[model samples]
Target chain A: MKLLTLNFLTCAIKTCKTNSASFPLHPRDAELEIVEADVNLPFLKNILPRLMWDELRGICTELGLPELPATPPTPADLIQPSSSTPETTDAAPIAEADEEPSQTAKDLHRVLLETCIQEGKLVCGACEHEYAVKEGVANFLLPGHLV
Target chain B: MPNPSTPAQTYETNHVHTVYEEIASHFSSTRYKPWPIVQTFLQTQPQGSIGADIGCGNGKYLRDKSQVWMVGCDRSTNLAKIASKNEPHSVIVADTLALPHPNGVFDFAICIAVIHHLSTAARRVEAVKCVLDLLRRPCSSSSSSTSIFTSSATPSGPGGGGGDDEGGKALIYVWALEQKDSRRGWDEGHEQDVMVPWVLKQKKEKQEKGRRKKGGDEEVGAEETKQEGDKTFLRYYHLYRKGELESDIEQAGGVVLESGYEKDNWWAIARLR
Candidate 1:
């Protein structure tokens, strides 16, 4: 499962739904793999504001990846500054298409879309219930008792 | 055989989940065509909108929109494995009533042809509530993040978003009881609970070998022998009567925005009330 998915997932237990600690399930002994995918800059920009930055940063830190910037990047920060001349400013309609993705966008895409957990267990902080991830598919099916 | 007294989960595990697991590949091969109503719903979501496909068998709808991010979940692990292959979308093994998603966060959700498998009325209503709970709650203040997308101007269809404050919408589909014109010919008075059989034919090579082992003289009992090689699994379904789906949504604290019958199934698009 991608780290992006972890943002939305919580402990499946009904009782844990009210617990603040259930959201952002923590990864344990995760075997990470990079599965390359084309970067969709517009999508990254659109999803940027919705991302829970602090939780994602904590997850990255837990996984021992490099620390992210203290704050989330704005949509403008994700795009490279247009290098076109003043003559091209008149072609405003097509200018948006010409805007290139910056290095931050690529890194963001790499973390959110490309990096996948091949095998691991996501431990719910509230109940300490572990959901196993195998072959990049996280099993969120709770046992009968948990359900 | 599960009786009326059997637990809904246990009954579904035997009659629904197991059947799908055993026939995942064959079932997925036959279910690639997206229904027009469902196709339109997925296509109209704003770019980069996040959604969930509950009980997404083989993830056919997941491929409908590349601009939106969708995460699919299924009770059957085999089906989830098949659905996980859809790029840019993830699939996890999860029960509908116990979905792992946090409450009130998704932009949209679709539970296509899945709710009918729950053997009880309460469980079915719970399933609808579960889908609604995944949606973003209605916001009184117009947040900048949501207002930034001007794509809402796209032509609104039957269940498309028309109001900004009405949270996320969920499209749910189920087999209708009033499908007299369909191949099954089931109508209003027919038994709503029925076991539908899926026959998986034995491979020709296997059949041929079995015949050869029986030594060509067993013609009298050939039909019985052939039946032995072929497997038939019965899956349980509770066909929805007209207005039942809408009622369930209402009972689950959802408001049905639009509903219609399509190709023997009743579907309704709903948002949390």
Candidate 2:
């Protein structure tokens, strides 16, 4: 029993590679597009939601976007930033401290563009789970063989 | 959520989780603190607490706790779909207004940064009522069954600040959309309310900037203004005082047995009266 236990321990030590970041089984960055903001809302009422307003607006200010509206048009029936369409080639838009998107009074186009960014797809990092990002929809799915 | 399916639900469901990314990033970014609060809450659960994460976003908080049974629910189909995609298990898609389970089913329910997201008072009331309705149960020997409900939120105002409910908050949010007409002019008072978050946000930014100047994490993204400006933002988010919240619990048929701040935000454990 002692010999067997010793042998198992020795084998385990030899097989267990300390660094997992280099392992083939390690997860990879799937680089999936994640829509972080609603740029596709109907024109009239497209400012950020209250939940998103402050954080986004603050970030906008720091990055230099037009100040977002305190109260924005309530476009209820507007099309949600819905869809599974991923920005195939569009780079994840990053907010900056210098660019202003619009000059319209109380307009938040610039801030929306800045506070928001496309989120990365959460693939297995190992399995190429193709989660598509369209209008902010993420589809983390697995192929038949991989499941 | 339906019962366990035959071969177990795999990853072939749905995919978009920017909500998750942003949510995780927001909390991870020091802008939000629900995760830490969740840890402490989890630590104190009495092994057998029937737990549920209201507006769970995706089972992000569902962890390996054999003692606690957890149910994660969110209102957004897009969110639920993404959550379903990323989660190892299936997440139920339902509105906060409707929960497909029996009353008194859970010993505790957690609503994390959820109340303020609602855009109207009616919807907010309905959502709260629904949760309360489910929580109300009959007892064996006692006259009434009991349960607990907990929520975390920030203060509402021109510079709507963030904090735990213990410090008390008056977070204002549109409970629901009342009309489809685009003609009604936006109210200025509401606009003032919006100012609160902006003001609070500015203050937070100044602090963060100061920290960065003093050797804080500069990698923190500083480019949200442009994008956020175009977004229809929250008027304000105010947290209620702990005592006030307990009274709210009492009104809803519960008792605020334990209430305190967790990470500057109010966190309380209240049982139904």
Candidate 3:
């Protein structure tokens, strides 16, 4: 699992739904890997608003990776087509140079898209439930009593 | 494994899991492509929508659509591993009866070719309700307006103010025992709950292959050896009759928005009210 996905998950216990601590499960003994993916800027731009930046940063810190900024960049800054270039400012029908993504956008892309946890355990804060991650798939099946 | 004294349901669950694990690789290869009907259902969703695929073997449906955040889960760990290889960080090993997600978290969901695996009527009903439970209501702030309003039948409200304008919607598909040319004419007393066999092809060892003489002699020998090594694995299936799927969903508190037969399978798009 990627650190980005963990941000959206909470303890599956019924009562844990309302407990704030149930979320943002702390990563323990995490083994991470980096795989190259075709960065879809449009997709990243679309999902930015839904991500909880603080939760993402917290997990990144636990995994010993680069931290996300306190404030994520505005969706417009990421989505706006680079129509105005430094060369012409408003050039006519000429081939334009590819615009480089901002430093913040690159950092977000690395943490959210490039990195994945190969094996680990997600420890719940409220009930202290431990979910194991193996072969990149988290086993979330709780005991029959918990269910 | 369940003892003989245990309920038949427990034994059935064990049978399904064991068979899937044994044939995970071959099963995944056979299911290389998603059904076209399922692809159309996915295309209807807006970009950036959070979607879940319950019992998502091989994650075949989690392809090409770059805009949707698709999460996949399955009871089989081996199949989940193959799926996660393609979609790292998005697959989970989970049971459909007790999914790991919180209520009303997913904007949309799909459970294809899954419900029929349950061996009993009550188990099928439980599986259907579990899928419905994962869906977020249509009126939830995150849902797309186009999805709900497009349906012709507007379900009555659980909310006083015209009810909650939205309930969760899902597409469910089940295998049909006697649809089209799928089966030979059935006798009067055909069983609904049946054990279907999956035949696994076995590879012969070098010594065995070399022992065979050359020419047509080898051909006859190979045919006989093939029969000896063929392993047939049995899986429990409760094939849905026509109208049975829709009835199950409605019985589970889902409002049937639309339902019909597609290809050899029966499917329905329902709103959980």
Q: Which stretches of candidate 2 lie over 4 Å from their true place?
A: A1-147, B1-34, B85-90, B119-126, B136-138, B142-242
At residue B88, what lDDT does model 3 achieve? Answer: 34
Question: Which lDDT tens digits does candidate 3 get at residues B59-174?
Answer: 88887556467778888888988888665338888778767676666667899988888877887888888788777665645532123322322111011223355665789999
**Which is the leading candidate under lDDT?**
1
Q: Please give the lDDT score at residue A97 for candidate 1.
A: 59
Model 1 lDDT per residue over A43-115, tens place: 7877786788899999999998878788988877888776774565556344445668898988999898888
Quality class of the docking in candidate 2, CAPRI style: incorrect
User: Which scores better on lDDT, 1 or 2?
Assistant: 1
Each candidate's clash count: 0, 86, 5
Best by TM-score: 1
Per-residue error at A134 for model 3, in Å? 1.6
In candidate 1, how many clashes are counted? 0
B-chain TM-score for every candidate: 0.83, 0.52, 0.78
| Interface RMSD, candidates in the order listed | 6.7, 20.9, 8.3
